[model samples]
Target: MIKTRVVVGVDGSAGSAAAVRWAAEEARMRQAELRVLIARHRRESFALDARQADADADTSTVQTAVQQARAVAPGVSVRGVALPGYAVPVLVHAAEEAALVVLGSHGGRSFFGQAHGSVCSQVATQAQCCVVVVRGGEVPADGPIVVGVNDDPDASTIIGRAFEEAAMRGAPLIAVTVRDGGSSTAEEALGTEIDLQLDPWREKYPQVRATREVIGGKPDKVLLQQCRQAQLVVAGARQQGALLGPVGTRLLQRAECPVLIARA
Candidate 1:
């Protein structure tokens, strides 16, 4: 049987539910098993009131989330997971066997945003597998999947994965090139320069209906606007062992829909 293993962390948020649904569809396309994990901290770590509450309540919460995924793809195998401690370590551990991890961005997903739902931020930077961030429920349709390419060769995974996702979702691929508009001279030639980089990707993923759009402006703003109603927005993790900076620190946090941070 084909196996395209995928995992997602749910915290009972609307965004997390969107991520779970997105991953379920992805697993269905890949004919893979879907694992839904919810980090359950030890009761002792919480205040006495919550600590004394029924542990089964937590288990039921996790099971409910798993059911959410199973509802989307009944044929795919589903597992409900609850671990002790913060979401990062628990999710990174799940990534040991997962091909991709899906997450949701809420409140403040940016570097300076509220830290309430930033678990995806930590996992994206450290997970062994790819991490997908979804901010809204809309999936790209009849439109190109936008990818923010960077200088890192590790970005190949993002490119390759975007093709697969676009093909599966029947969305056109739009390879976008954004240069620092901080200076006029750099801005003038950035569009043409990005087209050169998009050429090889077009050839490699030819089967995946795609085109290139070279936009001049800030990377974060351009990407956010492109992802407004997009099926998916993908970017490569920074080469420095962290998925920070524009994509990680900002874009992934603010994009309206799902954003995949594949290894670069």
Candidate 2:
């Protein structure tokens, strides 16, 4: 039976392994199935390459990733599928029915090098649902969940997703607002507006402990500092241009914990 699952991309990279672990844990917490996906491009097709040895190897890689995910979350329902297509389109289609999509910060890269923009970024940007980029960090059992909000309409979507995530993990939610440069009066006013915007979430998720902070600084830097103690950091993506917002891209590169980008 087809079920809603936390879909994760696995390509035998260290980063992909880390993503598998995080996705498995998240699936367990959310009481959802875990689906591990690996995409093989047309050029990598088994019939065309090395008389099926390459296909066998690719299949083994997917199965090994499935095993690792199962090890991470024992008893959680996990399945692996190997698809024939490019990474971006394959993963984006997989997200159609997924509760959320999780990807590693970098995939199939030897060194932990530049990943400011990669397949993960593209998939996250194009996916219809939420996308999580799992980076290096030990998510503490009791760490708070951090979310960055703005004055844009997309902030509502971001904050709502953050509340749901915090409730699922039973962790406190920290709502951070970064202003470029505002006077104390303007800051106070913006803080009040933000609080008003959070009312719906508060009522919907009364069990979640929510706190708000507004300060003048660069959004990316401020959120990175908050990530120092957070289990997860969430940011909003514009509905129009770009798959990921500027701030979300930065956090994916530098966050100590996993970063979730909620599409508006």
Candidate 3:
């Protein structure tokens, strides 16, 4: 049987290193192959000497990332490659056959800079599979996997992924639904809706201890607060023209832990 592949993009930045570690662990847990990729921009000049130097640097970067990944996951199969192209397109193409695409929250000034907003968002929006943006400090091994729940049709995709992850990591799952009103009736209704969404997944993954919460506040703010104690946050991509909606964008930018954007 062909093993699933997890593709991760890495520069020489600390954030990319963190991504490598996270991706390695995830690949090991999923029993997948880890592909470490480094994208080198093709220079306009095309000077032979400069091109050679760029190739050498790219090779070194990818090799170093591969070593790091192997160190993190000694039993998992890992490979490293340096491709010549822009970061976003290169990763998106790789994601075509990948089970998951993992990236750092920050890619320094060159590629994955969160400040630029174009690279990460574009890849997350365009990738064929789910995208994980590794952010914040070290994830607590004991922390629960938090997932944002709503009435959207894609809620099943998000909750299903969340339960799968929780089962893989042997962690509890917390399903959260945010409401604009503080009325008791609204809270009860929202909680019931979330339970309806989660019941099937709970039965499917009986090992995962799951709970539901209905909070009255902004979606992003409430999720961010929950992220403080979460090892990972799962959110659904918008079903419309856009993929990462406002809540997903904010979590990608400011969440206290890694955010997994479940693709519809």
Candidate 2's residue-wise lDDT over 174-241, tens digit each?
Answer: 99988889789999998998899888999999999999999778888999999989999988766335
Per-candidate Cα RMSD to the true structure, in Å, reads 3.9, 3.0, 1.9
Instruction: Choose the strongest candidate by lDDT.
Output: 3
Q: Which portions of model 3 show Cα errors greater than 4 Å?
A: 1-3, 112-116, 239-241
- Stronger candidate by TM-score (1 vs 3): 3
Model 2 regions more than 4 Å off: 1-3, 44-51, 107-116, 239-242
Q: Which of the predicted structures, 2 or 3, would earn the higher lDDT when compared with the native?
A: 3
Q: Using lDDT as the measure, what is the rank order of every candidate, best first?
A: 3, 2, 1
The ten-residue window of minimal lDDT in model 3 covers 107-116
Residue 165, candidate 3: Cα error in Å is 0.3
For residue 1, model 1's alpha carbon misses the true position, in angstroms, by: 14
- The local distance difference test score of each candidate is 0.73, 0.82, 0.87
Q: What number of clashing residue pairs does each candidate have, in the order they appear? A: 4, 1, 1
lDDT of 1 by residue, 1-264 (tens): 322789988777777777788888888988888888777556465676775453566577678878888899999898887666667788889888888888776764421122644676778878888888877556545657888766566666667778877877777887777765457667546655665666666687677777666677777888888987687888876744654655556776667777788763
In candidate 1, position 205 carries an lDDT of 65
Pairwise lDDT winner, candidates 1 and 3: 3
